[model samples]
Target: MKRLKEDNLKHFFAEETLKKYSVVFIIILAVMLICELFIFNFKWVNSAFDKKVDAEMTLSGINESGTDLKFTSDSATIEYKNLNEELKYLYFKPGSNKGGVADITLSAVDEANSSYFSAPSRTVLTDVKSSEYIRLRFSGEVKDFKITVNGMNGKTISKDNIGLNVRVPLMFSWIRFLLLSLTLMLLYVLRPKSFVYNYKTDLSKNWQRIVTLALVAIQIITFWNMIHWNTGVLEWHKSYEHHRQYYSLIDAIKEAHLYLDFEPSSALKNMDNPYDFRERYAQNVAFKWDHAYYDGKYYVYFGAAPAILLYLPYNLITGNDLPNYIAVFIFGIMIMIGILLLLWEIIKKWFRNTPFALYLLLSVVFGAAACLAYAVQKPDFYLVPSLGAIMFGLFGLAFWLSAERKNEDGTTSLISWRLAVGSACVAIIAGCRPQLLIVTVFGIILFWNSVFKERTLFSKKSLKQTVAVCLPFVIVGAAVMWYNYARFGSPFDFGANYNLTTNDMTKRGFVWGRTGLGIFTYLLQPFNMDAVFPFIHDFNAATVYQGLTLTEMLMGGVLWLYPILVIGLYGAFKKNSFSDRRSYRFVYFSVIFAVILAILDAQMAGLLTRYFTDFVWIAFIGTIITAFAYYEMLRDNEHSRRKFAGIILTFSVITLVLCFLSIFAHTEDSIMKANPTLYFTVQHLIAFWM
Candidate 1:
């Protein structure tokens, strides 16, 4: 009977493992809940456990106006002339400016000594009209100290209406609990011995379609929420009005013209140098900003492809200007699909054994690594061209790869329609963002056998295939060139040189000196992190290069931000890893061309984070190719395969988190400014302790 009991116990532990481990997971979560409530957020626990108490001390200050102390300027200092007490919390009433929420930080010095300073506490004045008092946690034994408040944003903060040792409301942070639970659950599921490691590729076509559809659904929900800010409807405001350049171009197209409808002001046209920003400002001229002013006509200097393809058709059909957000949403969705399809096609061709989890992870990395989220976040005409180019680039490459099929003899044959479709998509990049035309050059290498080795100037089959590839380029190329020639008098000139904004682009020739700065800033710079909620901070673009270089705040380098991209170096450097030599060349050239484009963007346009869209996807896709290569290499060893997949999953999750945080960071047109309540709500949700 004892032996039978032991056998039954063994069966329960081994056969019902998930049931047993689930209980363990629940126990761990319960422990975490207790720790969070009792230890991490004990202040709230204490508040709940005891009745509320009034302030033990009150502080007052008088400004130069002899009024109750208010932050009249961008900054203010409040000094307690005499005070000696153990302070735990500070409170003050903040009045909003009605424009936007202000991020106010208070730094206090204890005992009038800088060395004995208390940690700074930041509070966002989210409610513009409410008379509620905001609280900041302060803990120190203090006497004769000063508190400095910064980032008033023109709002008045009452300093005299301040209280020390104030009791905060009972705060059971549900958000903190939810985040902890999710973290724990995710870690538990991805544990080394979990079934996640045992997952294998589902090779059925239906499974492939399901995976693609799942990604599409995720993209749909994500982009919808991002574009609408969780509101069911998109808000229309003055910010959209300023960036309706696409509508301007569409109106010009409706009138059978190439230039925009915004006529150049006579004061601006009469000036000898219309591109001179200071001269225009000094004269108070009313010319279109960022528009190409050549021969007194204002041209939308941004690529005309978005207008010609998307906005123009929508305007004609709907009899209204197409919103840039809609266009970005469409382009953004297609870009994600193209990324997944391209990756899927490559996986089908070469790395068929790649795990579904790895495939999902790399797909996400490539999609997010492209930084199309910036375009989605801003959703303006400026990013339309870049977004479209990446979409077309991915689709074109995917189609080109899909054209090849295996034969009965274990060789490959090319499909004509796929080649034509791929070439046409490749040619469209010229119309979208001409700088990204560099991607199309990969075609020659991709079709090395058909172009160089076969050398077909005649013969029926070869001629038909040749026409299949070249005809689309000819048609699209001719149309794009004609459009350019009609606008700029030269097929090659996209009219960016004549832009009447910022520096004179016509003379902003390439400087070799800027290349090093561009490479480091674009591809090598490490993330500047902080202890704050959104831990990642913008990379400072300050450099020693003494020149007029147009630089913008960067998030971080592509590699440092997405560490999985380092695997791309393995593919580029390793020659024997790939079974197909052409695939090897593709990876090698992707890295090479990405570097070249980075240098070009740095030299021509300077270092802007938006310009990362030009090459990051290329590097990311190359990395995906190599990551799968490494995964397939470990196919015989399940342990190594799981380890490799875990690493990819880990990096991918980190990258996704960083990408989400970036949208809320203090940057131009950030969500904090667009939707302050939502921003502060999420901020307080995740950072409840703060």
Candidate 2:
């Protein structure tokens, strides 16, 4: 009888393990299938004008077993021979920049009938440099596909050329899906436990584990995708194609040509030359977008970090440059992760016993709204400041939080070095985007009591420690000032005045009259949704945002998208809701700055959606903290069903809206449109709209 009971227990254990495994396995399997079948898209480039080609398609030969197709070619003999049993789409991506001279007369000697039914194949492929999609479709049976290029000048096309990638129909290529599937599958089988975070730790550790596991997985996917994606040259040429000074800076660096005094310049028609007044002028030497023309050289007004960090290292390694789109993607993942980490710290600090699930949910909302919905769209010139600001601010805040960790005995250790490190991170705000320097105040809020002893203004030890924290910031600040001085001849002037943009920055200043409207547009403007794939359309609002700032059609203000923010404002004034006064003050401090910074951005930067990324994070974090506080009240209430339900329903609605908002964030201008197959596939799923 005892032996039979033991056997029964063993069976129970086996069944439970299978159930756990099955849940995870199903999720993994769904992801694998979706990646393989659903999320497939690619971007192709021409040898000329690859920078602007928006639409791309699949590699076509991937099947159930595996992808059996591959490319092997040298500079001279370009070949994509069919090794698969089926004939796949012949996808050739070209150029990285908008303009390049590429006239390739290719002799396409098809082995089989390279025709879609009876329709004859397009014999001549001309204007390969154009940004618009020109189809080179082939549907019939084809075996070997070889193209011997009639080279322009002396450079023959490489069979395995750069900037050209194989695209599938969705957000990823088939080859990419196959590769990711195999890698993830291998990982699952080998280290399955690590993929799922252990939730048995303290509330803090639980959130940490969840974030860490997620970070590893995303970094792996993002890194793989970054390398595999057909990103054009990530260099001065591609990145600074419009902003010419960056390109010229790299040229000046490589050539060691330091010229300031007497170079002949082209002035704008008959206007005085901005660079050298001695020659013919082109009115806008800065040419396009927002660039600074100084001393006969074009300078990017964005930041120096992109050049120093991304472009330089990429050049050293790949013999090519890194594009802002690819750079933003890589940094986007980091910034997203960093933002989550920052949120976790704030949540833990605000409410020590906050549930891990709630933390995760809040992080999800923040990630979906900030990272995926808004920031991911502007992967071009905007990436440098937007993503950079997010990264510098969030991680800087996170590092500052780590400077003090409470022990089990309730004693806090002051790690002065971390404070310095944190300051160092924030200091680079000078280079990337200084607007986020408001976040640095959180550092002071975190470190203030320590910096000042009880009943005294300041302490000697605290003062010394403050110096340590301020040291890195001072050094980095000096470096940025020096960089500016060397380029624009003024430490204080970071070239904003010199920008040739939609408005003249030299004449642009804070308009107190328009700021109220700017604030209205920043967070309160309504979103417009149309009957389209990307359902969210432009906001047709009568705005007082008459100031000079370039922005897409408003997709509603931040408040319209996330209404739960009111909970925080309500919680702030509630007596006895917060556990402690210090944390409560900190929350308000962050909230005040967040809103103030939004106003500052509206005043300085104007009414752009991506600038919302600068401050919306504070609103998201504040809401989460307040919601936690509000929940504590409901937990202790006599009859809390209606209250709890109301809270849950409100949160539930926000979450539900966010899920759709993240995907259908922008119609017509949606990244989903990049993958026509995936876009249409998902579009077809919703025939009710049709």
Candidate 3:
């Protein structure tokens, strides 16, 4: 019952002019580049402080002058080991000028000779509440120092911490300018040629352009959120605290000189392998987080695609590897692109009658927001599989879906470049998550006709299609298998045996007994909610069966979070409603694949939220396809049934908002714990109006 007419997205362009926008973007980028060059000449933009408040931390005294950070008071009088050298620095948590103004005044006290050295007071403003240390940078260190907080209000503002941090302004440095230039260049290439001009690229499509623009906007926000409060733990923390293993391996590749040997790596711990682990006399000891140690060489147990594709090559070209979070963030954006393309392809095939908004809705839900924010939560080694699967799986599937598209002359094009790319994507999908091979069922069903067209095993055109499609798989698969052999001495071994998991994977086997219970928990597990801001909580450990299988904390089952996914099985429930035999067959196969993946994960990988990434996408894709079919049924039949569509739209909007908020409020670990300042800032920002 929705209007058939579509909105022209031209109005959404920058001031209705693409050229104007490009020119302005170029100007800004040029300015940034010039500024970076000037910085290279001079030390900084300003001879004095840059007026940028990097951190806003509460005050605390250093217990032993450097290690444990327990901030205490706004003012501190401390004695240092060296009178003129050690105690000459102070820290700041910028003031939130809403109520009053404050500045941290430091006066170094020379206890032996009644002399003091203090830097000019720097004004402060509220910033993201992470601590930053400001060194006095005086000629010599002072052992005795006194910090005075000057506030306009007599109210004792709590903001103080003893200095153990000496921060540089390199976080947002010249490197950002180079990155900015790259971003601008890509934008230029992708910019709309002319809003009104129809071109070979699909950029001419009115709605697709809007969707791409929305993607660009979303990327800005996601990238901002990734590094907004990067606490620097990922820099060089020695332990397995977070994504240290990921970057540590990258650092090893860069400096260790050993192909994959981890030595001379960036770390707070000793990196020199004086023990000569990779040389003559060595031990077979490996670092934690699945770094396999075999014959004095350390091989990363995770997928080599990320390192080979992103880290190693990038480090070689740029002389350093980027933060793993940045890679995950970019991959997350690609996942969105893939999902968007997939949904668009689906709309082209089945839901051409539906509105463009519907396509975008399904795309955003399944592509970006599905799985309760697991993909973008934190860019650690834990995310490598989820990110890889999302990028390769969705993109591969999207490309496959675009295999057949209608032409302008009412004809169809069966031969699409996407098919070959999709074929290769499916092959890589197994490397990302070996279990995702189940999705290949959908692809097989998709090309069922093409496979059947040729009566012979090999035909001229069919052979070409097969070669184009299967070549990437053959090459990538061989390389992956060879990589395994090079590392673990077996082509099939991915070194999961040497992993530092709770239980030894080499010793672990399938827990078939847990399948029934795991299926129930994975599909029907109830979501826990509370009155707290982040209402969702972890699955009750009691609900899990008593077994030896491993599991991670889960928010809820797929069905509990998104119940509408059950519509994927609409064919079974409302038989004969689907007139399109091919579409019905696709849905049938998708359901089977979903079931297979769920069983595999529940029985094999264990019941974990992250594991849901394996099969939950099936529900997402199937739900959209089924919804469109149902939409057609309503449109062709009783118009009164249209209210159901309206209800779904209204409910979907509400649900998405709640889901977004729930991710923010997820219990135990979330934005609330990861960055308390961001969480409080959001709460306060919301509270100001609410």
Candidate 4:
């Protein structure tokens, strides 16, 4: 009773201290948020439009000058005339126009001295709108006509006097900023507050509270920074306009009219009418909003609906652009929560000590290297779902590995729920990225095998149960397959049409997985790849070298220590003395199998480092479990145990440092140019290689 009272008192004081600091942190964060609003000028609508214009201009440039541009037989030859002023417009016979204006320079060649015209000049034009055909009455004789035809047969026309204007939309600029501010204000008000202080009396409760607060903070911050809150402001208004433009499609649908019914004569048989054909044929066009609309085929493309769901009424009220960043942010928070849950489960099943739990948590959260890797590598979004699926599989295997399940009396178990949710998460992952279906299948098979070890192909009951458990996933998988088939005419076709046209087979084949060289570069010599180490070029190393700088290697190493621990646990399984050895072994094998499957899938075309991030995480978990299993081995020998612990700790620290350094060193040149100081600080502290 006395001890309990003392512990309670200690906890109370700690809570008080935490409360005091948390208050300060909240105030500071609030002030910072306000200051950020002012410091970073938000231009919602104009910026969005500006980006669109820039994209259009860039695309126009590429179409005009890129080597890939192909001219058809029907292309017309246009004439260029020298203008005395800084700006000049060239008139063309209007038709359903597809091309934009491009600047062309002309120079006269002299045969006498073989010299070109001096002062080779330049002219710039904007708003080069094109239309079908224009009938013009000419009164004067045109002179010095130089025709530079871009398409098949060259044809040219000359004109002298033309009009030009520099028109800019000033209203959009201010309206966008205003809308952005309103959205930010809404987000700020609804942001999570001092929930931690409410549950400070109990340590366990306090931990949960802290984690929740942390997740909320991460979500808000990520949404604000990563998604760019200002971008949403522009989207909100644009969405309405998009809906207005697509009203015709809706009307046609309501009238039970097919695209062919409305425009039988307008069927696009040539590339010239592709844009018009696409606009007419595509259905479910609620709003032709930028990337936000569910791409007519039911495949979630824009990720706007989910983002809007995050804030609900507040977002609707403020008319904020639905930023997909919210989804990414939430995904990241879920990952952190999932990790914490896994860690808690590990501690509960192994140490069962509060101090040990605290230590592990602190080490994970505050370890310099680990923190750096986590900050830079934005792996949480996808990693969490993958890890969650693995965790479910592991827990299911644990049920099968139970020493004497008959001895225990329980009709219902959490394992069933874990299996269902885990399988669903895996299905979701597969749906999001079809390639991951291979990993999901591997996990399901591993789980089944773990349950029915030597019983082979004849175990009907086990097979039935497994099938029943996986039915939901099968349905989801089939749905996804059907979706792919609908989109590309073949279930397995991954939209290779773009690749076919580009004719960049290197990118289409195995090079850099999707394009350049091949998966060999990443697998045979991961260290040499730009992803692992920016400077290293060697590819002949026999084993994985710490190609990353010391700091980066250390950080990444610490986070990945879980895989090593799993390996150690597997080795200990041979001892046959530990009571839970078999369970640990099962987990170890399952994780290893999953990793192998992930690696194999990644070795094919279209693999990336991020695609294999989940494997790294699962490997880490296995390592931790192995460490827990072998804890008693060290305790039995004090001197040896101390040495082992020191060595492991040192190695973890070193690896963590290296990981952090590797990620930190790669600066985002694009971001830095926009906001140099902020970019530099964040890049050094948290930005990941991706």
Q: Candidate 1's residue-wise lDDT over 1-690, tens digit each?
A: 999999987876565277877876787779878977776555555444333223222223324334344445565655564455555555555543443334444555554554446555555453522212244344554554455556653445443545555555544556567777876776666654566545555536687577668867977787777776623123442344437777877778778888777767889879988888888899998977777888879777677777788988888898987777788788988987898889878888788877676666567667776865666556666777889998889999999888877789865567889988998888889878888878776677777775555543124657777787889889988998888788889988888889877887888888888999999888998878887757777756878887878887788787877777777867899978888777777789889988999999999888888888898888887788888787788888878877877777777777777777776664665665567666666666555555
Q: CA lDDT of 136 in candidate 4?
A: 18
Candidate 4 to truth, TM: 0.45
Q: lDDT tens digits, residues 172-275, model 3?
A: 34434676577555434333232221221244488669766786577558545744343332332334533555455666655743235454222312334322
Q: Write candidate 4's Cα lDDT for 1-690 as tens digits.
A: 999999986775455365645554566556545443443322222133321110011122113433233223243223223322221122332112322232333332322213323222221212222111111112122222222323222222222112121221222223334444554443332222312212212226666567546744654464335434123222332344422222232333335531211221222222232223234345322222221111122112211112223433434466443332343444444555455455555445444322342334323532222122432334223233333343333333333222112225532122444455555655655444444344454344434434555342225544644554576578867765665565545665544222211122223232222221212322223343343322222222132322211111211121232223334435434545344544355455645544454445433322333334434544445555554444445555656644544444545544544453444333321222333333333332221211
lDDT of 4 at 407: 20
Error of 3 at 643 (Å): 2.1
Better model by TM-score, 1 or 2? 1
Indicate whether candidate 1 or candidate 4 has the larger lDDT: 1
- Report the number of the highest-TM-score candidate: 1
Report the candidate with higher TM-score, 2 versus 4.
2
Best by lDDT: 1
TM-score of candidate 2 against the unseen true structure: 0.64
User: What's model 4's overall lDDT?
Assistant: 0.36
What local distance difference test score does each model get?
Answer: 0.71, 0.54, 0.56, 0.36
**TM-score preference between candidates 1 and 3, better one:** 1
Sort by lDDT, best first: what order? 1, 3, 2, 4
Query: Which parts of model 3 are misplaced by more than 4 Å?
Result: 1-204, 219-223, 226-287, 293-297, 405-413, 453-461, 569-572, 637-641, 667-669, 684-690
State candidate 3's TM-score: 0.64
On lDDT, who's better, 1 or 3?
A: 1
